[model samples]
Target chain A: MHCLWCDADMIPELSWKTIFWLSRPTYLCPPCAEQLTILKGKRCGKCSRESDEEVCPDCRWWAADAAWDDPLVRNYAVFSYNDAMKEMIAKWKYRGDYCLGKVFEGAYQTAFKQAFSFLSREAVAVPIPLSDERMHERGFNQAKMLADFLPLKTWDILTRNHSEKQSKKTRRQRVTAANPFQLTRTVKHPVILADDIYTTGSTLRHAAFVLKEHGCPAVYALTLIRG
Target chain B: MDDYELSRRYAGKLLLRHEILIDEPRFEHLLNAHYFTSETAIQTKWSHHECRRCGNQKPSLFGQIPCHHCGETHVYCRKCIEMGRVMACSLLYEWTSPDQPWPSHPNACTWEGELTTAQQKASDLIVRKIQGREKEILTWAVCGAGKTEILYPGISEALKLGMRVCIATPRADVVRELLPRLREAFSGVYIQGLYGGSLEKDGTAQLMIATTHQLLRFKQAFDVMIIDEVDAFPYTHDTSLPFAAARAKKETSTTIYLTATPRQEQQMRMARKKLPHVFIPRRFHGHPMPVPVFHMCYSLKKDLQKSQPPKAFFKWFHHRKTPGRQLLIFVPTINLAGNLTQKLAAILSNSTTMAVHASDHDREEKVQQFREKRFQILVTTTILERGVTFPSVDVAILDAGHTVFDEAALVQIAGRAGRSPSDPTGEVVFFHDGKTEAMREAVRSITRMNKRGGFH
Candidate 1:
């Protein structure tokens, strides 16, 4: 495998981690990852994990040097969620079918290829993991299934650590949790995070922070849609 | 073709809603199977076959034929003519002359896209039917196949032939689409898009595009009648329109039927006689038909009753809506639509949303808003199910188990999505508290239609 950070080839080493029935190569060798610099999104640098060129409100109020969380950027979506999308959503949501998800895979892959082709080779995708409680209720995180098609090492990186639905919590509560992403298992660095949807960037941004804190390289997020 | 002349020949054929009938006609399986108002004063063809040469031989097809000896045309047998029964002798000729720079210019037809093969074929058929002087034609094409374009060729043909043509539908959208096309195609020709508000009593116009209900006012103003959305809501259900179409058509003119699904009589006739019909089963963009999937929800209902949302259902729903998949939601009633709208709003708080129903007096505004995507989820009844096409919107019926959710409604609701060339296949989800036989039928029907890749 080619080392993602150093751009050098590494001797093949086997691992027990198989993301799916399609047993595929999983990671970058240690040397390349060690040399990597993790992403520290320029967030408000304090509370909100999403950031821009400026130090956002919360960080400014706290008088903190808001440079730590400064890598995240606003996401660009491929299509508007039109009436057509609403219909598809209603059908799948009401009837409880998963095969309909396949239609978006090709489109999402196409968008990803066109928009982020430069990173395709080194990008290891990690689907935003569902908490154990939600997992038991919904049986799956749709993003995980879609991520399977891409050449990425998958992981249940975020263990919910706390069981509250991330949706219910205000942006602040999610990040302050004792352990947002447990890293129960680790993966190849320079990963691309995957999820079905992105809103407020609270979940992905927090996960990105945890991964960077754990010595992972720059985290890039890819989602079907962003809001 | 004057109004009086058309009426003389077709007087006893069918009764319009206002046709001086004291009592509504009950359909009977007589020699000629058709509905007849008790008020109908039928003049049986058996009464007279007035042929100048062959007096009283057995009456041939449809009560009108040529004389055996003189080879001259004969409308009645020798008995009626001799007895002064005076059966009307009529010569039928479909005058089809393409109006070069048709008196009606192509102003209304600003579709802004290339015509599909179905539209072309329908137009050609319209021309041929006019030329052949045929009484009826069935244009069995699907909803988005663009029925308006099919009528374009017929518009000018009817005009140059000096025929007054009326294009009728059970719904307004059909008229709305056709009005512009007809306006464009027959530019110089005086045309009227008639519905309830716009009525041309002077009969000054050569063409009329109107709802079937509007046909009641005309005694026989049209020589060629094209009915759009033949199997749609009111046509088959309302006793008046079909009868009016039959009554309004001039003896020398033609009537063409355009529909994706024809009524029972049309189907039975086609099947029994194996009558050939022009079929355009796909939308103009040439995409495969949508495949409908059925999800059994009875087990999920029990789970919901246990005070838990159906995990499997949510899993499936979340996966499909995983962005970029358009959707349509159909509910049994306006109230249900409202309730579901609230639930969906709560569930998908991040997504834009809107709900629409028949009860909404501001329906036109809501529909226009939905088209613009001012609101993503347009909560609707069957009103917007079939005719309104929004690109890429997949469809689902919330309570698939309801008895009101019949085969017709299901097919219409399922047709709401994947209209754009960019995204061609629709996602159909039938969500039921308890799975019903109709749900299975709906799924199977859609699958079969799509298995042929929409060639049907």
Candidate 2:
């Protein structure tokens, strides 16, 4: 097989140790896979950033607000938003290389099972949806692709109103902008919101706000990367 | 917007429709006034699978994306997606206006250096062709024949006639090397150097030097387009670059193709009298091309695999350790280059040798250090085959029979030797387990050029 990014020939190596750990061979070469900065070590409870503080400054700001009855519970991200991650996301999302969604499939599956083990089997995985125009252009919603790899029952419970892409907005604008997500169906079970990347935590928070405004009792989030 | 501002900004420029929308505040009035015309970037009908722009019918290069604006599925060409997405939904805007009078200086040629007699003759022919209405001309010169100097007179003629000119090459490194020389030669003319990360994309210039990929951003922009290294990689193999080159020039503009080793197709065309070409077989210093000597070494890769340099290669290296001569060894791949450099450094002990390839981030610095004589030998891949000249350098090709080394590449590699006038003779050795047709063709081409002799 050839690497998707560099087109280098990748001969699969047979080793009992690797097979035992990884279950299956990796599609990416060693060097190309090394470029990804996998998130590890002590992380913030709210945003899953590499942090020593129990509650990071951004999470403290979100918690200090009394506007909402229940604050954001927790979030988990699998990778750090390094330059390589940024480029990979751009190629996969903006360039419409849908095949690249599989690069994160194995990692996302492993991370998802580990992050949300406390939730029951009936807890639904609702992917953050794209507007109809974005869905038409991109053909497939990237967040839905990530959620498809989760071990939970996935559902399309939320819909997005047409607005400027969150990627094109500044942090202050993103945090202060009006919520663009609306609940399309009533849900009583616990929920896990899935997105490709968590930037500033405003997008997931907005989705969580809409879900909480409805009848959902609890909400959690999982993302591919934390920017 | 003022008519002058609109014309100055958008005239002779090819822009994507999305670019226009992003800059809508500036182009809104002009677009609405019908001053700008739009053409499909990659023309295609729903029934046809072939792309009109690049003529690619391969399914892998074609993709379908739902168009948000038109509410239809649009098939786009993905082969030239690096330039931009060219789809049925996309439009390329060209400003339709009267040609603005270009500024020309009285004395555009400021170079004091003299050209050889053969170069002067070729320069005259090129100048005459450019001044006349010839559509295409080929300048086929031997390696180290001072091909860049021969174009000076022709370019100066175009500049004096108030015509916009462009000197485009396939590689960005070539563009970087040619820019300063062209700037020094034509000091009076405004020259803009363009590449991937270039910042000088705004201004209008009399002479524009750019890579072939940058030509995609231009539309009928040049009156004369001179493509250097016409047979180089990516340009020769990829069809989109040649298409971009053709699209960058005006309908009536002249094109000059400059290359050291013309491909077989070009040679056949010239032989049939279908293409006009000029040939220069000798270097400016009156030296014939260096013929490479092939040495048989049994399984060099196997020997290197055991951490042993082949006996023949080591013997040659030990014998050719002269005082001032630097050695350049070309390997097939980057991994082999690194291993060979390590083994050679251990064997030589007294001399400093380094390996450089495309992925080496410090490649420019390493090359600059080699030029400064800090390294005695440099092991590299084809990344250094052309656009680099080191005086008093002996070249050796390991595994010359490797599939990566084509006839054109081998010729360019051998041409690296004997470049300096002070030391007109340098050794070129090809150590291979078996000789391939490419090696034989390289030797034969050099012998043929040598027989033609220099124009005195």
Model 1 residue B294 CA deviation (Å) reads 0.9
Give the TM-score of chain A in candidate 2. 0.94
Q: What are the runs in model 2 whose C-alpha is more than 4 Å off? A: A1-87, A93-121, A126-145, A148-227, B21-29, B45-57, B66-73, B303-311, B321-323, B338-350, B454-456
Best candidate (score: DockQ):
2
User: How many residue pairs of model 1 clash at the backbone?
Assistant: 46
TM-score of chain B of each: 0.69, 0.92
True contacts kept of each: 0.00, 0.03
Residue-level lDDT of model 1, residues A1-227, one tens digit each, is 44322224666644555333454332334643333222234534333234583655643533443645644433334334444454444333222233345446555666667656777475677777776655543434676866775665666566655477655777667545555666666555577777765655667766776777777767777766543
Query: What TM-score fits each model?
Result: 0.49, 0.80
Judging by lDDT against the true structure, name the best candidate: 2
Candidate 1 chain A lDDT trough over 10 residues, lowest sum:
A32-41
Classified by CAPRI criteria, candidate 1 counts as incorrect
lDDT (10s digit) by residue, model 1, range B178-266: 66666666556666776644445323356777776556444444678887777776566545567666656666778788776666688
lDDT of 2 by residue, B272-332 (tens): 9988999888888888877899999986879867646689988888787464699899988
